[model samples]
Target: MPAIVEETVQPCPECGSEIRGDGRFTLWCAACDWNVDPSEPQPDAGRLERAGRVLARRHGEQLLGEMLDGSGGRPRRDVSAVAATVLALAVHAVTVVLAVGGLWCVVALGGGIGVVAGVVLLALAWLLAPRPGRLPEGRPVLLRADAPELFALVDEVAGAVGTRSVDAIVVDGSINAAVTSYGIRGRRLLVLGMPLWEILTPEERIALLGHELAHYANGDIRNGLVVGSAVRSLTVWHHIVQPLPHATGLEMIVNALYVLPRLLIGGWLILLIRLTSRAGMRAEYLADRLAARTASTPAAAGLMDRLLITEALGVWLRTEANRAALRGPRSTRRATDRAGELWERLTAYAASIPEHEYERQRRAGARRGHQVDTTHPPTHLRRACLLAGQSEPAAVALQAHRSDLIAVELAAARTEVARRLLRGVLDD
Candidate 1:
C-alpha cells in the first residue's frame, strides 16, 4: 500500500484547544472558532501571522502612549528646541528695537497692557471653555434595548477595519452622533442619538458606527480636541485685551481697534477649525468605504441617506419649535384655538411630506455641485458611490426601504411634540 499522510491539527489562538480538520480546507476548533482564515496558509504560519498582528497592536499602543506622553526614550527635540530659542531671542530683539524707536513709549505701554490682558483672558477662557472633565466619557448608556445588536454591528465593522474595540457607546437624545476621546489614556466613546437608533437599520447603523470608529482610528478625535483647545487658548487672549486700560477712552478705543487684529487671528482659528472639520468629514467618508468593504456599499449608502433624512427632520423640528415660541402666549381662547390649529397644520404638513421630498428640498438649499453639506457630504453622493454596481440594485432597494422604515419611525417620534408636552405637564 502507498504511504498515506494526514495533516496535523493545531491549537486555536483564542483558546488553547486542539483544532481538527473536517476533510475541508478549513480547520475548526472544537473549543472556539470565533475567527476563521483560509486554509491555504499553513497552520504554523497562520499562528505566526496572528502573533504578528498581536505584536503590531501592542507596538501601536506603545507608540500612541509615547506620542501622548513624550516618552519611549526617543531623542528630545534638540534642533527644533534650538530654533524655537533662537526665534524667541529674535522676537525679543525686535521688540526691544521697536520699544527703543520713536514708538517706544506707546509700544511699551501697549505691550505691557496686552500681556497682562492676554494672561487674564487666557485664564478666563480656560475657565469658560468646555471643560474636559465635563465632557461625557466611557460608553454611553442606551435606554433602548436594541443597543446590543447595534453594538454588535459596530463591532463587526470595526473589526473588519482592524480598529480597536470601542470603549463605550452612548445614546444621547439629540439627533447627532460623535466620537470623543477622554481621559489621560485616551479611551474612546461613541455617542449616538436616540433618533439615530430609531432611524438607522442594522447595516446603516454599522456604517454610522464604522464612520465614528474611523474617526477614533484615524486620530481625528484626538486632533479635534487638541485643535479646539488651541483655538480656545488663543481666543482667550482677545478677551483679556478688551479689558485693558490704555488712555481715558482711548484704551477702550485701542482695544476696539485690536478687534480687527483679533478678528484676523480669529479667521486663522476658524480656518484651522474648518480644516479639522473637513478632515473629520473626509474621515467619515473613508469610514463609509470601510463599512462598505466590511459589509456592502449599498448598506453604507442607505445609512447615509437615512442619516440625512434624520438631520432634516431634526432641523425642521427645531424650526417649528422656534416658530411656535415666536407665536407667543395666546390671551384669548379664540387666539389659543387659532394658534393650536396653525401648529397642528404645520405639523401635519411636515408629516405629509415624503422623506425623499424633504431630502430633495434640503439638497436644493446647497450650492450647485455640492450634494452633501460641507460639514457632511450629501446622501445622494454617498448613495451614488455605493450603487456603482447594478448587480445589487434589489439588495440596495431593500436596504433603502429598511432605512426608510427606521426614518419614519423616528420622524413620527419627533412629530409627537404634543405627547412630549403632555408628559411635561403631567410631570409638573
Candidate 2:
C-alpha cells in the first residue's frame, strides 16, 4: 500500500490554479508549476573556485559541441592537456626536491639550527606528499560476509565495466554515490548514498554502480595519484601563503612577505584547472558511456534523470525534517515514530514527482549549468551524450528477488541514516 498524500490547496503565484502537496515536500501549482523549485542558485565562492567553475563550464560546452558533431570516444590530447600534464609533473618535481633537500640537510648538517630547519623542511615535504585516500570514520562499512548479495552484484558490474571489484561498500546519508581508493594498498571502496539509492530503480542502481566503477577504467588524470596530490599540495600552499585580512604590525609584514609566492601558486592553480578541464570532462563522458554499455542505455539515461532531481530531493528531505521537527511539539506522535517514517516518506516524495516536473527540472538544469560537480560536465550534456552514444544490451541486471535481498542487507544502514538525518534537523 502507498503512503497517503496529505494535500493542501492554495492559489499559485504564477497562475490562480490550486497548488497541492503533502506538507513535507514542495507545493506547486499542478497547472502552472509555480514554485516547483524555490531555491536560489548558489554561486561558487572564492576567486579560484569561480575560475575553476568557469573553466569547467567552458570545456563542458565545447565537449557537448563535439558530441553534437558526432566526435566520439576519449578526446585527443590537445595543447592545453599536454601543457597541463607537464605542469603537473613540475609540481611533483617540487615535492621531490623538497624531500631530497630535507634529507640532505638532516644528514649533512646534523646540529642545532640545521637540524631545526631540516625538521621544518621535512614537515613541509610530508605535507606535500601524495597521500592515499581514506575511508571516512563514523560511516557504516558493509563487508561481503554481511552483504554478499550486494557485493556479488557489484562484482558483476565491475566485470562488465572491466574494473576490479571494490573491496568494501560504505553506506552513508549523502545525496550522491562515489567510488574511491583507500589506504596504502589502494583498496577500492564504493560509497552508496542511501537517500539517492532509495529513490532509484534497481536497474538505475546498477547503472549508478556501473558508472562509478567505470571511473577506475576511464584513465582520469585528475584522479591519478601524481596529479591529484599536486593539486592538493597547491591548494594547501595557497591557503598557507594567503594573506590574512586586516593585519596590523608584524602580521602586516608577514602578509606582505607572502604576496609574491601567493600570486605564483594561485596563478599555477588556475592554469592547471583551465588546461585539465577538458580532459576531466571527457573522462566523465567516458564513464557514462561505459555505464551505458554495462547497464543498457535506458538505465544509464534513467540514472541521469535521477541526477537532475538530486537538488529537489535534498530540498524535500530538508523540508520534511523541518516539518517533522515543528510538528513534534504540537502533535501526539512520538519523535521515534516520525523518524521511522522518513524513509517511506522520501520514497513517496520521489515517486510522486510528475512527468511535467521532470521536464521543468531538466530545462532548469540546462539553464542553470547544473552538474554533478565542478569536475563533471553539465547534467544535460551527459544525458544527451548517453542518448547519442552507441547502444549496448545490459551486461548486468538486477533481478527483483536479488534486489530485495540487497535491500534486506541494507536495512540497518537505512534506519541509521534516517535517524541521523532527523536528529540533525531536531538538534538544529
Candidate 3:
C-alpha cells in the first residue's frame, strides 16, 4: 500500500476563499491574492521565499565573495579613516607636549581657560557620537511575503535572475526596505516595512527591493559598515579625554600651545566625513542605476517617483503632528475640532496654486543649492535625475505629473524645517 499524505484547507486572509494545502510551508490567501509554499514558516512566508529566490539568483556571486573576503568585504585601506586617525593622533600628541611644557603651568596660573573648555566640549561630542546598530544574526529577512501576487512576482523575477533560496524575510512598520549583512561571514538579509508594501504597486516594490540587492551585489553594505567603524574608532580618542577635569590657568596656556596642531587634525576629520558622505551619495546613484538596469526602466522610474512623493507626504504629516504637539491643550483641542473644517479649505487652497509654480521653486532651489543638510540629496534633484534618464515618451508623461510629486515633497520639506526650528526654540 502507498503512504497517504494528508491535505489541509484554510480560508484566505484577504478574501473569503478556501485554499488547499500540500502540508509543506504554505501561505495561501485568495482575498489579497497570496499563494506560495505552505510549508515555509514566516510572517509572510510566500513573500520571503520569493525575495530569497530573487536575491540568491541576482547576488549569489557577490554574496559569496563577501563571505570569503571577510572584514565585511571592505578595502584594506580607507584614506578617510587614515586621515582622520592621523589628525586625531596629531591632536593628542600636541596635547601631551603642551602638558609637558612649562606652558601648561603658565596657562593654569593665567587666564586662558577656553582651551580647557574646548577640550571638554570635544570630549563630550565624541562620547555622544551615534553608535551603529549590531548586524542582524543571519541574513536579513524580507517580511509580509504571504501575499500570493507579490510572492509570485518576486519569484518570477528571482528565477529570471537565478538566485538561490533566501534565509528569511522580516517586516517593519515604516515605509522602508533595506538589505543588511550579518554573522561572521556577513550573510545577506532583506527587510521590508508594511507601510511601503501597502502603498507601492508590485513593480515599484520589486524595484525598491532590487535597489537594496544592488547594495549587496556592489558590496556597499559591508564596505559602508567597515568604513564607518574605522572612522568611529579613530575618533573615539576624543572621548578618552572627556573625563579629565577643567584645566587651571597654567594648563590652559599649555593647551593653547597645542591648539594649532589639534585644529589642523580636526580639520582633516571633518574632511573625512564630508568625503565619505559624498561617496555614499554616489553609491546611492550607482545602486539606483543598477536597479534600473535589472528591472525595467519604466518600473525603476516609477519607483523613484513614488518614493519621493511618499517621503514628501510623510514629512508633511509628521510636521503637522509636531506642530499640534507643541500647542497648549486648549489650542490642541480647537485644532483637532477644526481639522475637519479646515480640510476642505486647505485642499482648495492647495488646488488653487498652479503646479508649475511649485516646480519652478524646486528647480530654482536645486540650482542655487543649500548647504548639505542630510546625507541624501534633495528629493527634487533626485527626481530630476530619474526623470532625465526616462525615455522621451515616458519622460513627457512623468514631467506632466512632476508638479504633483513636487508639491507633496515640498510640503513635507517645509513641515520638517518648521518642526526642527520649533524644537530648537523649545530647547533654547
* Most lDDT-accurate candidate: 2
**Per-model TM values vs. the true structure:** 0.48, 0.86, 0.43
What digit string (tens of lDDT, one per residue) describes model 2 on residues 281-366? 88788888888988899999999988877877877777666765687654413544455577778888788766655666666666
lDDT for every model? 0.47, 0.79, 0.45
Q: Stretches of candidate 2 above 4 Å error?
A: 1-40, 75-82, 323-340, 370-373, 389-391, 425-428
Q: State the lDDT of candidate 3 residue by residue for 2-65, as single tens digits.
A: 2233466778775768866544223354345454222222232333234333433333334233
For model 1, residues 1-428, the per-residue Cα lDDT tens digits are: 12122455677777888765533123444455423422222333333234333433333334334433434223233443334334334433433453344243434446776656555544443443433423343223432343444444456656766678656555444555777755656566667665455445565666666666665555443244545445454455445544465456777787777878666645544444433443434444555555665556766776666654554446544554455456564422233334333334433433443443434433442322232233444454445445553323111122455545544433433334233322221111
Find the number of clashing residue pairs for candidate 2.
0
- Where is model 1 more than 4 Å wrong at Cα? 1-133, 136-153, 221-225, 231-251, 270-281, 315-359, 362-372, 389-428
Better of 1 and 3 by TM-score: 1
Clashing pairs in 2: none
RMSD in order of candidates: 22.0, 3.8, 21.4
